[model samples]
Target: MASRARGLNEDGGFVKWDWNKNKYIWVSKDEINKPSKPGHSKYAWKDGNKVAARRPSFKVPVKKACRQPLQVANKHGKMKTPSPKKPSRRPVHHKADFIVPGYDHGYDDGYDEVDEKENYPRNEKYNAREGKIPPPPELHSGHTTILSVMSNRLIHVNAALTFWRQGPNEYISYVIRTEDDAATVDTLPALVNCFKNKTPVSKQLSLGACFELLPTLKKLLSSKFEDYVKTSLDTLRTMLRFWWNDLIAHRNQSFSGDLQQSRSVAGIYMSAIAMTDIITKLCKRKDGIAKKAEIVGTLLAQL
Candidate 1:
């Protein structure tokens, strides 16, 4: 060990067995900021370390960092890139006495089956009450959702009354003139309401509403607007179905015991007769209405 140390510390061409150790001490050129002749006893590797000698060129600026040499003696060492700190995991908490409303397991109330009418407009009241807006209309066929909560709330034949009261034929005229897809969809909820009943009033009004629709209906058959034509045809077909269903409802009620008390049989009979005449008149024309006479006849037969 002493010989090895001497050989490293010496700076002579020939080995000196006992040349003064102090005078012959070797200073490493790689040593940074090192003296010209540092002694072997005051060695840079005093602790058996091979630290790179710091030179004038190796003076790191105050702003810069000097990286330490790796310690090879230790089997495991800190890596340049640290092992990722273990994630600061969220601590789990036990459930307290407070109940989470929707989190309740297997609760099956009427909320699961809310039959939201597809074309029903988003009423502000309903939105507040329900806590959600209905999706916008899927089609631009001039049909829109009901404009009012009252319109939305109307059920059975009342929706059909709203349809007529709003003047559907005139609404159709405006929609056709404007040629707006949104306007076309706007008319649908009312037209749709025309078929939303099995009542006597709905049946009678369904026929008149078809007649009211005839102007817009005829224009649609020959007009260039495909979506308008489709909406008109569908509306006409649906009204006929409503008429037939109302007739059937009337038929069930015609000879019933309550007919004597309310005495609405004559009105129902007149509505059926008038529907047949108007439909037969429509059959005389070369329009699509005449083409659908078979369905009309079937509807009349059920009456």
Candidate 2:
């Protein structure tokens, strides 16, 4: 006989062959321990084996389809994960507190972002307050102020040439000949003496005299006495250089003064500019004198 498990079958019960009655018999868990014939055998166990007859197979009922859309099975689905935003690479610039009020800091639209109403008081009472009115026309007149502070130190050609050597006999004899002759004879020597003194006031006066006489000298001797003309031009050029340097030094020194004094300083600059303008015009002439006065004229013009 074949060995088997000593328990009830998985399908609930088993069938065994009865040797005494020469037939098969059904056994349940309660009768599993009953004695059997020595050579009798139990039916082989099978997954479908059962003590009772098997029931008919049944068919399942189908249901209606859903109206909703089908979803994806994966948790990630069709949507993509967005990458994290990158940090800005540009540096932020903040306005400085110590900067001047009207100074441009290259902000938006080239202006400061200030609230005018907050910083400046504005109201009918503030507008109507006493002492808020503008000054009278007499006190604030532009033309009057300008004329009042205008310099009286006018640089006339006659006044400048007063430093030239003039004697009583020469003045009396001037009616007999041309003023050009006097200029030719005395201008160079006077210039030599003026610089030889090495005084600041005298040097300034000498520069004025030289500037006044330059055109006359150039016109008179530029064609006849080339050597004398060259010497005179060279001397004038040297004087111009020294005078220009002095002018620059004086200009560079700041002067804090009243309106009249300031206007006087401005007048000096104006005179210098006018003198340089004359030299510039002379340098533009077609004559060879232009070549001689080029360097000095250019220097003064730049200043």
Candidate 3:
């Protein structure tokens, strides 16, 4: 029979197993006399309680192996097509309309001989009926014989002083006159008049008397004699100047009067006026030696 009161150290409180009586005994050092037999029940012997067995060792499940994220290729849109270029059109060439006959390429081959032969007789007939003289080959076409005459007159007047011839038995005579009358009367006429009159005492004197008196007079005049001659000549020139002015005034008035009545008269008057004015100006200088002589003598006499 198992003793109910028997204790095992592993149990919480006093408890016993019926088959293990000797293991359940409460042994003490003071009770050595009540010792159990050796090897009688070895399994039944108890000193201290055994610890509870630990739970079995186990491995935790490993995390599922992660897969790497997949890489996707990028998509591109379609490429654009290039437009085609157009070609340029060229300009058309044009041919000339009126083609002249008898023109040999670029050369003149005397092919117009027939035309000339047909026209020549008609031209001659027309010209003959008009009574026009054929021009002389040697003559100048633009200038007339009148121009030649005018040019020759200019040359003659330029040489008039030295080369002019006097009538036989003519003598040098001095005449004094006012400026207004000089233009209409010729110098030769006045000079002839002075000789005929025999008015100047100097002219009538004998050669001996002239010789005797001239030296003394010349001495008194000295260089001034030249001035005296010039003074007398100035008086003559004044006459010429007034004459020219009158002539020009007359021509201009005549031309203007004739302009409405007759163009030919007006043209003739204008031409004549132009010719005279040009000739007068050419022969007479504004500051002439004669004028200077007159001025000098007057100034000296005043001094």
Candidate 3, run of 10 with poorest lDDT: 67-76
Which digits, one per residue and each the tens of the lDDT, describe model 1 over residues 161-233? Answer: 4544656554444445554443444456566665665444343443443544445554554545545545555
Rank by TM-score, highest first.
2, 1, 3
CA-lDDT, candidates in order:
0.47, 0.47, 0.35
**Per-residue lDDT of model 3, residues 1-303, tens digit only:** 876774554333333443444356444444445565444232321332221111111222237742211111111233456878776674222222112345333335545433433454655534433444445656766478878766755554433322223421122211111121122123334433433455462244232321222222222222334444333344333322323343345456666774233343333233333333323432344445534444434332322
The TM-score between candidate 3 and the true structure equals: 0.15
Total clashing pairs in model 1: 17
Task: Kindly report which residue stretches of model 2 are placed more than 4 angstroms away from their true locations once superposed.
Answer: 1-181, 193-236, 253-268, 284-287
Q: Is candidate 1 or candidate 3 better by lDDT?
A: 1
TM-score of 1: 0.25
